[model samples]
Target: MAHNALPRPSSLPGIEDLRRGYTPSTHEARQSIEERSKQLRLEQERIDAELDRHIAEMQRLSLRRRDVVRELDLNHALLAPVHRLFPELLSEVFIHAVQDPFNVQKTDFAVRVLCGVCTTWRAAARATPLLWTFIDLSYITSLEDPLLRLQLQLSGQLPLTVTAKVQDQAMQLLLVAFFDGMSDEDASRVVEITVEDDGVVLSQLRSRHLATLRVADVNIWDTCTQGELGFLTSAPTLHKLTIGVQYECEDDDAALAFPVPVIPDLPCLTHLILAIENEFPVSAFLPAISQLAPVLRVLKMSSFEVSAWEETKPTVTCEMHVLHSLELQHYTHRFLTFITAPALHAVTLIGDDAQLGKEDPTESLLDLLTRSRPPLRSFALHDPMQGSASALSGCIDLMEGLQRLNIEDNERGVTSSPRLAAVLQRLVCDENTPPMLPELRSLSVQCRGDKSPCVHSDVAAPLSQVRLSRKDPRVCAGRAVAALE
Candidate 1:
């Protein structure tokens, strides 16, 4: 392209006189100077006009260049490898890219990002029903919000896992609408539900195939009546139930008023977890387990008030014939006296070390083992309040079939080193007696208290002997000794 050359002023009328600093003393000379100044002003305006035109032209060309680059980039993107991928494969990629679709707080952003990528990706995302199956209405601001409806619609007939935090009246209304909008078939496709209740009576989950239900409440005073939870009784396929409640009891007498939520008999219920916060009398809830799901395989309980059972012994004993695993926290060995699990294989107990005066759980554990004679393989005891060496050794003597044993003394009290050493010594086999745990494959002893030299020296010999006897010895000692293989 040919460009026009900018014009320059040839010369000033009195250029030589002005350079020489000649004064315009006469009227004619001053008049002549004024005329030249006027001409110069006219020329300057013409030059500025020309510059403006060229500047405008350059800007126009720059915009055109940008448009051309964008077009080329779009064309190149169309030929990319990802564009060649089948929609089905791309949908799977989208599914993996989005982590925890049920967590609306995070997955909602991911879904939006995937949809905003391109028309093809948006179509693939909408077509993938699995991505939309988790309909979280926890933060739904308005009933008119289309995201919730879109999720349900795109999910189609696939099984849904719904989660909602019913914090206010608006959220409760949305939750109701969420269920009301669903067709009978769509409702039946709901397999799992997690609801955090805040004194709201939730719409009964009407799914016949409902397998898991997790309900948590920060306030225990707002009780869910049996009538409110009547839907659980009809949910025959429900296998897992988790109820977490935070109770604020003012006094010991308040525990007497503790209301036990109606837990309906779920015949197929296999796993049950009750996480109760704050101090509530164990008697208020423990006895009810006898009538819980008969075929329950796992029972985990936490944060229960450990009552002095010596003063008031529990007459009622819970018999769980098919229970395979049991875990309890903030409890004494006395609590074990109230339960019997014959099929139990794993037991984890986290004792309240603050209550150092409590009786050792060794006898209670021995009693339970003798009573049930379960094929116990794994046992983990953490911070036992009054764990004695003799008591622990006696408990080990009963568990000849134990495969994994983990004992942790976090307090490192006066008895911590001797207790750990005694347990290790009990594991050693001699000429007179048979091995304590012949099937033992893993032993983990952790003492967080002061490390006594005698502990390492005493347990080292026993640990070496035990390792020599076993084909695969995996012993991990924390702060006391190094791991042995």
Candidate 2:
């Protein structure tokens, strides 16, 4: 009964048996790992340095590539036709780029965009006075904005068309300052101006420089202490003037007479339009119109408040000799009796719902026409009330010179088609009472309620007969009916 035993291992072994027999204690293996980790970290550091060198080289090459592209672009630009164009040609192009100088809301985009292109372009655009002449001060953010001064200086001796809208008190003061600071020479350069503000801006520009003024949407009577509208009387050169005022008073007692002292004689004022939105005493505004009658070529008054006025016998008859066009809207018959236009060629009368059945202006209108004996050619009556149609028909009876007649009854809430039809049917050639407006060639009829062809047929039949009896085929253009309805 004998047993066999195995041999014990040694701490170290020869290279031949090392791979199979060698094994380290726990501490010895940890120490060996530490040494290997340190060597690997050092090797990683070396590799990182090489990577840094490559990255730096790539960055340097990228900068050099950009420089080369920039130079190529510059060379290409030099050869371009636009770059070779003379400054004069560039100035002409800049002038052509400006769009809609009359639009008060638009900014000066043309000059700004052209000047921003390059230093050379900026000099060329700035030197062109025509480009800066249409300076819109509406978009100016502050008084300190250099745009106003720059534009004024760049414009040099050329005339300017200035348009601005003031939204606040600060802007109004700024506008006043802009005009107040303008030298006499610079102020004289302002030929045309359109301002929409609270009347202060215009009062500052009372220098005798402005020629044409269109003051729109101005709040006057309520804002001004004296309710003065004589803002333009100082402009001796003013030829064309348009004034629109809004009365924001809550009650009639709050209403004040506009232009308290009354508008002075504008000796040179030829074209005048005064549009009042709310009710004002005719006595207050009529004097202004009467004063301008002598020199006025065209007169238009629109949107007056309806009120009864005491009629006093006028000592002197105001006559307008050069007046070619007269248009009155929302006014009473008594108001028309004030002034007479002898040379009137065109008359447009419009009455609203408020003017319905208030007063008969036809007698005065007929009397005025008889007295003036104007060569009235065009007449338009829009939205006339009930009794107004028959009374105005008398106008046709008196006016044998009328060439064009337009009758529109849609907005007045009343229809006078039947009465108008009767008047048209009565048009006949007779020795005692000749056909009304024998020279009438064009007739325009418009009705909103019943625009059916049958409604206008009664009037159309006689118009065709008149044209036929006269043996004038050229009386109308395309159709026997002047308008569809």
Best by lDDT: 1
- Cα displacement (angstroms), candidate 1, residue 456, comes to 6.3
In the range 1-485, model 2's lDDT, one tens digit per residue, is 22465554655324544667866558978698688879989999999999999999999999999999999998887787877789999888777667455533323464557777788888888888887777676766555678877777788888877666676777777667666666667666776766666644455544444444423223343343332344455567667777666645344534433442245556777877777665554455666677777788887777664743344546677777888887777654455676677788888777665655554445567878877778888888765435545677777777777788887654333333565566556653443443566666677766545434233455566656554554543223222322211
| RMSD (CA, angstroms), candidate 1 | 11.5
lDDT of 1 by residue, 294-352 (tens): 77798888875455222235676788888888887775345577778888899887777
Q: Which predicted model would earn the best TM-score?
A: 1
Instruction: State the lDDT at 18 in candidate 2.
Output: 62
The estimated TM-scores of all candidates read: 0.71, 0.67
What are the per-model numbers of colliding residue pairs?
Answer: 1, 0
Model 1 shows how many backbone clashes? 1
